[model samples]
Target: MKIIVTYDVKQILTEESRASYLDEWQKEHASLLRECDHLQFEMKRLQKKRPSDQKWIADQFDKEIRTRSERMSFLDFKMDQLDQLTLGAEIHDGEIQSIQEVQMGDEWHGREQKGKIVVKDGIVQSIVPDSKGKDIMI
Candidate 1:
């Protein structure tokens, strides 16, 4: 029997474009690496001369390091979020026009293993296995 699979092709395209933009922005901001390196070097230098360093100097170093680290972390988080959203597009393009049937031990979007894809309202509803079935309703 053919299985129903639903998905928003447009949404997938939009996500793909967003991911590309984010990736481009990350590449353009490659200077972040240099800034991180500089901050690390400065911190090490100050640490070695801690005895002669002023309190304000250490505080400023800490602040700068924290800010830089947070920015990097935020960017990483955004990238990961986009990746998850666009995972469907990564599997296959176009659309699942036919009732795509899946067998056991089959992989969907590089996922663990086998199941039948269930689509509803032009979106993925669930992926249930023929034997040990589980609805991935979303």
Candidate 2:
């Protein structure tokens, strides 16, 4: 039998990764800013044509603008955080799923071992504690 297991992916930050992240975030920020500007322009044009619906239209636009503003703030914080990360520091990238073989009587769950993948410079550095997930028999 085989079962699926989840393992954490960790990245060893380097100058290359940092620059990549900053560049990506900058592009996203610019796109978001452009969207906000377009929304503002549309809102103004709509309110000018329909004075009676101005308040409702403004409220809807304001809601969307506020949401984007909050996201931009968060992106700023993320960019700042990325800038502060030191080279060779490990950070959690995300998770991946793996398949593991198991026997009928095997205790396949509740193991207290680290299932992790360490990567550096876009290459797999190591599979921690082996693919069996660092488990031990009691």
Candidate 3:
């Protein structure tokens, strides 16, 4: 006979961990939110100038404004997802307790494509290839 046992685990976040995550989230979210707000304001400003501007210029501005608005909406959706993840992490105290392995996919930005330094306890342990496929040894 095969049997499996499971135990409930309580995840607790240390003050440092909580602060780190909260600060990181706030910094990123605020930047994106600010950009979205700016894009929205620019769109409105452009719309107001439409009637007085040259036809070609007006059309171009309108197209750009619409594009910006669409991008802003997408950013808003991303921010909402981040908010949900933050809430979940807080509830779990940042402790991922489940033993199940999961495959995760991520997009790598240019900055992350280069090698990155991993620092733990204020000490640099090693330099590793970032989220990209390149490998770097420290």
Best by lDDT: 2
Stretches > 4 Å off in candidate 1 = 1-16, 28-30, 46-51, 86-138
Query: Which pairs in model 2 have colliding backbones?
Result: none
lDDT of 2 by residue, 77-137 (tens): 9999988888999989898888877778876455334488888888888776445555332
Superposing all C-alpha atoms, what RMSD in Å does each candidate have to the true structure? Answer: 12.2, 4.3, 15.0
Compared with the true structure, the alpha-carbon lDDT of candidate 1 equals 0.58
Q: What lDDT would each prediction earn against the true structure?
A: 0.58, 0.83, 0.47
Candidate 2: Cα lDDT at 23: 92
Q: Model 2 reaches what TM-score against the true structure?
A: 0.81
Ranking by lDDT: 2, 1, 3
Summed backbone clashes in each candidate are 1, 0, 0
Please identify which of the two predictions, 1 or 3, would achieve the higher TM-score against the true structure: 1
For candidate 1, write residues 6-120 as lDDT tens digits: 4322333355466564776587446666687898788778777885775667788778877877887777776676667644443332343335667776655523233455443
Better of 2 and 3 by lDDT: 2
